[model samples]
Target: MESEALLSVRDLRIAFAGVEAVRGLSFDVRPREVLALVGESGAGKSLTARALLGMVPEDATTSGTVTLLGDTDLAAQRGLHIALVPQDALSALSPVHPVGDQLAAAVRSVARVSRKEARARAVAALDRVGIPDAARKARAYPHEYSGGMRQRAVIAMATVNEPDVLVADEPTTALDEERRDQVLRVLGEQREALGAALVLVTHDMDVVRDHADRVLVMYAGRLTELGPADAVLGRPRAPYTAGLLASLPEHDAPRRRRLPALPGTPPAPGTLPPGCAFAPRCPLAADLCHREEPEPQEVEGHLVACHHWAELPHPAVDLFQEKQHASS
Candidate 1:
C-alpha cells in the first residue's frame, strides 16, 4: 500500500551559474514523519531543502518538481506552509531585535494573527521548543541567548505558523550534546503537536539514527541510497554508505584498525565523477562503477543507486563485542 506522504520531490535539480548543486534528486516525506537528508557539508543537503522552501539563492537556476501536499507544487505554494530553520541560527536571525518579535512576525505573516496574538503564540512556540522562561526570553535579543537557546529560538520562529513541513538544516550545529538531544526531543514534540512532516538535513549519522524515521543518503549531489532509517543505517547497501557507517563514532562501534573514510573530497558541484560520483572513494567500485552512473532502483524496500550494491560485503565490525572489548 502507498504511504500517506506529505511531499514528493521528483527530479529536482539546481544550478548556480556554471555549478550544478543538485542533480535530479527525488524522495518523499510522509505526513508527521522525520526524514533525514543525511550527507556531509557541501553535499547539496541544504540546497535541496532550500529548494523545497523556494529559498534557493538568487544566483541559482532550478528545474524539476518539488510537490507538497502530494499535489501542490512547491514553486506555487512557496511560503504559505513551508518553513525553514537554516543552517546558521545566528546568521538566520537579526542580532539587534528580540527573538520574540521575529517569531511573531513569522506567525503574523503566515496566519491572520494580531501582534499581541502573535506574541502569545511566539512565547508558546518558544516554550514548546524547551526555551527556558519563554515569556522573559521573548524580550531578550538573539545575542543575549547562548548558541543553544538561539537555535531553539530559530525553531520557534519557523514553527510558529504550524507549517506543513519543517526543513531543519543542521538545526543543532553549534549546540552541545545535552542541548542537541533537547532540540531533537523538541522537534519530536513539534511534530506530534502539529502533525507536520519534518525534514532534518544533517551531516551527523548519529543524529539520523536518533531522530529520523527514514533516511536519504546523497553523494556528489545525487541520492545514492534511501530507505527506512533503522533498516538503512543498520544494513547499508552502498559502499559509500557503508564507509559512512563505519566512520560513525558509536559507543557500539569497535575501536577499529582505523576508522574508514571516503578517500577523496566530494566532487565540485559543477562536475561530478564520471560514472558513480562516489566511485573514486568507494572500495567496491569496479570498472562499470567508474563509467556508468547507476540509477536509483528499489531492492526489497530500499532504493539504492549502486550497481554492485548486492555484491558488496557487510563491513566487518564486531559491534556488540566491540563494546564489551572496550570495557575490558
Candidate 2:
C-alpha cells in the first residue's frame, strides 16, 4: 500500500459460482481526491465498488488487499473507516425506522457516543447535505421524502461517521438533468466537508468530466485505461475508452443526426476471449490483439492496455463521424 494513498486496491478479483465478475482490478485513491470508475453495465464497476466496502454477496468470493486508514484488510474496518452510499436509497434505508434513528444507529454503532449526541449529529448531517428543515425531515421515514431528498439522506448517513473513504455507486442514476447535477453537487460538497477520498462509480462521461480528478475505464471486467480525467476523456488511448466517448451524443451535432454507438455489446463476464477482451470491437485490432492479451503499459503518462493504442487515431478526430458517413 502507498503511504499517501487513503485507499489502495491491488489485484482485486471477485467470482461467483466460479464465474469471475471482476479480474485483476487495482487503483489508489488519495484523500480528497475524486476517482470515477466509468464503464457500461456489467463491466464490473459496481461489483468493484461493493468489494471495496466488503459488501459483496455471500455467494461471491473476493480476493484483494484493500488498505485504508491503517487497515490492510478493509472488510474488518467497514462502516467505521469506510462508507458506501449505495445505488438504491429506498432499499438501503429501513422503512420502519425514522431516517434520524437509522443515522443515529450508524453513528452509535462505531463510536461511544450518547444517543442524544448521535441524533444531533444526524440532524446536522442532513443540514450539511442541503436538506431544508432537516430537524423535521429527520423524523420522517424514507417514504416521506422525494427521490433526491432520500438520496441526500443516504449521503448524510454515509458521511455521519466521517469515514476516510466514501464510495457512491451511481448516486444520480435516476434523476433528470437538473436533479442529477444537484445530487452530484451535494455529494461533492459532503466529500469536501469531510476531506475524504471519493470513489464515484458511474457510466456518465459528463459526471466524470465535472467531478473526477482521475478516471478508470473498465471493459469486460478488466481495466482498459487509467489516468487523469482530462487526458483520458480528451485524448483517450484505449479503444474501449475511445468507443465510449464516441458513443456519447454530441450536443452540438446536427439536428436529427443519429448518435454513434459502439457496434457490439460487451462480452459476458467469465466468458471473455483469450486475448484482449475488446479485440472483437476494436477497429484497429490486429492478429496480435487476438493472439495475446495486452498487459497495462505506460503510454505517455497514462496507463493503457492496448496492443495498438499508439497507432489508433484519437477518438475526438472524426472517428465516429467517418463511420456514420460511410454507412450513409
Candidate 3:
C-alpha cells in the first residue's frame, strides 16, 4: 500500500457459485479525491462498490485486501471510517422513522453523545446538505419528503459520522438532468466539507468528465483504463473506452443524425469469449487479441489494457464513426 493512499484495494475478486463477477482489481484512493468507476450496466461496478464496505451478499465469495489506513478489516471500520450512499434513497431509509431521527441514530452508533447533541448534529447535517427548514423537515418521515429531499437526507446520513471515505453507487441515475446536477452538486459540496475521499460508481460519462479527479474504466470485470480524468476521457487509449465515448450523443453534432453505438452487449459472467473479452466487438482487434488477453501497461501515463493501444488514432471517436458508416 502506498503511504499516501487513504484506501488501497489489491487483487480484489468476488465470485458466486464458482463464477467471478469482479476479477483481480486493484486501485488506490487518495485523500479528498473523487474516483469514478464507469462502464456498461453489467461491468461489475456496483458489486465492486459494495465490496468496499464488505456489503456483498451472503452467497457471494470474496478474496482481497481492502486496506484503509493500514487496517485490512473493513467490517470493523464500516460506518465510522467508511460509509455507503446506496443507489435507492427510499429503500435505504426507514418509512416509520423521522428523517432526523434516523440520522441521529447513525451518529449515535458511531459516537458517544447525548440524545440532544445527536439531534442537533443531525439537523446540522441536513442543513449542510441544503435541506430547507431542516429542523422542521427532520421530523418528517421519508414518505413525506420529495424525491430530491429524500436523496439529500440520505447524503446527510452517510456523512453524519464524518467518515474518511464515502462510496456512492449511482446516486444520480434516476434523476432528470436538472435534478442530476443538483444532486451531484450537493454530493461534491458534502465531500468538500467533510474533506473525505469519494468512490463514485456511475454509468454517466458526463459525470465522470465533470467531477472525477481520476477515472477507472472497467469491462468484463477487469480494468480497461485508469488515469487522470482529463487525459483518459479526452484521449482514451483503450478500444473499449473509445467505443463507449463514441456512443455518446455529442452536444454540437447535427440533431437528426443517429448517434454511434457499441456493436454488442457485454458478455455475461462465466461466458466470456477466449482471450480478450472485448475482442468480439472491438474494431481494432487482431489475431493476437483473440489469442491472448492484454494486461494493463503504462502508456503515456495512462494504464491501458489493449494489444494495439499505441496504434489507436489520436481522435479515437473517428474510428468508431467510420465503422458505423461502413456498416451502413
Candidate 4:
C-alpha cells in the first residue's frame, strides 16, 4: 500500500451462496479524495462497500485485499481504519433508543469513550451534520425525528469517530430536495473538516458531478469504468456507461423530452451475461464482446473494462454531446 492512499481495494470478491455480488474489483482512495461509486441498484456498489466494512449479510462470503495506508489489507485489519453508514436507513437505527443516544452509543462501541464524553461527542456530531439545536434533537427518539433528520442522525453516528476513511451508502436517499442539498453540503463540510477519504455510493449523476473527484462505474459484479469525474461523466467511453449517461435527465440540455434508456434490466447475479456482463444491452457490443471479458485497460489515469473501448466514441465531445445537451 502507498502511504498516500487512505484505502485501497484489490481483486475484491464477494458471494452469497453460488452467486457473486462483486468480482475482481480493485480501486484506490487517496488521502482526502472523494471517490463516487455510481451505478444502478444491485450493481455491486453497496455490496463492495459492505464487504470492505465487513458488514455483509449473514448468508454472504467475502474475499480479497482491502488495504488501508499500510501493508495490512482490510481482510487482515478488520475495518480498523474504516467506518460506514449502511444503505437501508430505516433498519440501520435502533427503533426504541433515542437517535442521539444510539449515536452516542456508537462512539462508546467504537472507541471506549465515557458516557458523558460520548453524549457530548454525539451532540457535536449532530451539530456538525446541520441539525439545529442538536442537544435537544439528540434527546429525541428515532421515531420522533423526521426522515431527513434521521438520515442526518445516522451520518452523525457514522462520522463520530472520524475514521481515516468513511463509506456512505446513499446518504441523501431519504431527503427531499432542500434536505438533500443540505445533506450533501453537510457531507462536503464534514469531509473538509475530518480529512477522511470518502467513498460515496450513489446513483445520481448530479451528485457525482458536484461532489466526486473521480467516478467508479460498476455493472453486474464488475468495475466497468473509473476516471476523473469530468472525464467519465463528460465523455464516458464504455457503451454501458454511455447508455447510463444518455438515460439521465439533463436539466441543462435544450431538449424537452426526458431521455432515452437502454432496454432490459440488469442480469441476475448468479447468471451474469456470458461476456461483457452488459453485452446483451450494449448497443456497440460485438461477437467478441459477448464471449470474452475485457481486462482493465488504462487510458490516461482512467481505467475501463471494455472489449471495444478504443472503438467506442467519446460520448460528450464526439457522439452524444448534442443529444446530451438537448436532453436538458
Q: Which residues of candidate 1, in runs, are more than 4 Å off? A: 1-3, 70-80, 252-257, 316-328
Task: Quote the lDDT for 117 in model 4.
Answer: 97
Select the stronger candidate by lDDT from 1 and 4. 1
List the candidates' TM-scores in order: 0.90, 0.96, 0.98, 0.90
Error of 2 at 46 (Å): 0.5
Off-target runs (Cα >4 Å) in candidate 4 are 1-3, 71-80, 316-328
Q: Top model by lDDT, which number? A: 3
1-328: candidate 1 lDDT, tens digit per residue: 1457678888988988867889899888888889999887778998888888877899988888877876545655644577887768889899888888988887776678678998999899999888889999999998899988877788788788888888888887877889788888877788789888899998888989888899999987899889999988888877777767766666865666445455668888766868888888766679998999999989778999999888766542333224334545
Output the worst ten-in-a-row residue range by lDDT, candidate 1: 315-324
Candidate number with the higher lDDT (1 or 2): 2
lDDT string for model 4 (1-328, tens) is: 2456777788988888967889889988988889999888889998888776766788887778776766554544433367776666668888888888887887777666789998999899999888899999888888888887777777777788787788888887766778788778877788789888899999888899989999999998888999999989887877777887877776777686646766689987988877788888776679998999898898767788988777777553333444445555
| lDDT (10s digit) by residue, model 2, range 13-111 | 899898899988888898899999999899999989988887888999878777776677667677778999988989999999999999999999888
Residue-by-residue lDDT tens digits, candidate 3, 1-328: 2479999989999999989999899989999999999999889999999889988889999898888888988887888899999899999999989999999999898899999999999999999999999999999999999999999999999999999999999999879999999989999999999999999999999999999999999999999999999999899999899998998888898988777889989999999899899999999999999999998898988889899998889799888988998998
Residue clash pairs of candidate 2: none
Each prediction's whole-model lDDT (CA): 0.81, 0.87, 0.93, 0.80
What's each prediction's clash count?
A: 0, 0, 0, 5
Index of the highest-TM-score prediction: 3
